[model samples]
Target: MLVLSRRAGESVVIGEDVTITVLEVRGDVIRIGIDAPRSVAVHRAELLEQLETVNREAASPSEDAVQSLSAALRSRPGNHAG
Candidate 1:
């Protein structure tokens, strides 16, 4: 990991589109601001991990199976009428 020292209000550029700036520093926590295009997604590390897990679960074939089962239920006799 690359680490750089930045004071409050200092900023670092990421790639060509994202900027991370130090907004405030308290005793143990530091607040930061990020500027990026709307198309870019930003999340905390833990939240990103959770989102990745959820996305993987959603993209798995089991989810497709579940959807198929739901469709089958809706198509069963007495479940819907033409």
Candidate 2:
């Protein structure tokens, strides 16, 4: 990990297009701003972990399980007898 010091309104550039800036500092809390292209995704550590967990769960589904779910939904009777 590369460490650098930045003051409020100062920024650091990552790669070619990404920029991270120090927006505010209050005692121990520091607020940061990021600028990146739409194609790039940025998330907090906890949120990223949640997304990874969801993706792992999605990728581990069995084909038969998915087909069974589809069949169950299709077989459900709809109420149209009003």
Candidate 3:
């Protein structure tokens, strides 16, 4: 990690388009603002981890579990499109 000291209103730029600016500081808490293009994605670490786990689960489903789900769906009253 590249560590730098910055006061409120100071900013750091990334690449050619992204800028992270310090907005406020109160004792141990600090607030920051990010400026990036609309196509860029910014996510908190924990939320990103949860999204990765969900994506992994979606990509690799168990065969037996899939069959069970298919059976249950087929048995539903209005599900006759099989």
Point to the candidate with the largest lDDT.
3
TM-score of each: 0.60, 0.62, 0.66
lDDT of 1 by residue, 1-82 (tens): 9999999999999999999999999998999999999999887999989989999987876967989988888899887545
List pairs with backbone clashes in candidate 1: none
Estimate, for each residue in 5-71, the C-alpha lDDT of model 2 and write its tens digit: 9999999999999999999999999999999999999989999899899999898998998999878
Mind sharing the TM-score for model 2?
0.62
Q: Estimate the overall C-alpha local distance difference test score of candidate 2.
A: 0.93
Ranking by lDDT: 3, 2, 1
lDDT of each: 0.92, 0.93, 0.95
Model 2 lowest lDDT segment of ten: 73-82
Q: Model 3 lDDT vs. the true structure?
A: 0.95
Instruction: Give the best candidate by TM-score.
Output: 3
Of models 1 and 3, which has the larger TM-score?
3
What does the lDDT read for residue 76 in candidate 3? 93
Instruction: Give candidate 3's TM-score.
Output: 0.66
lDDT of 2 at 45: 97
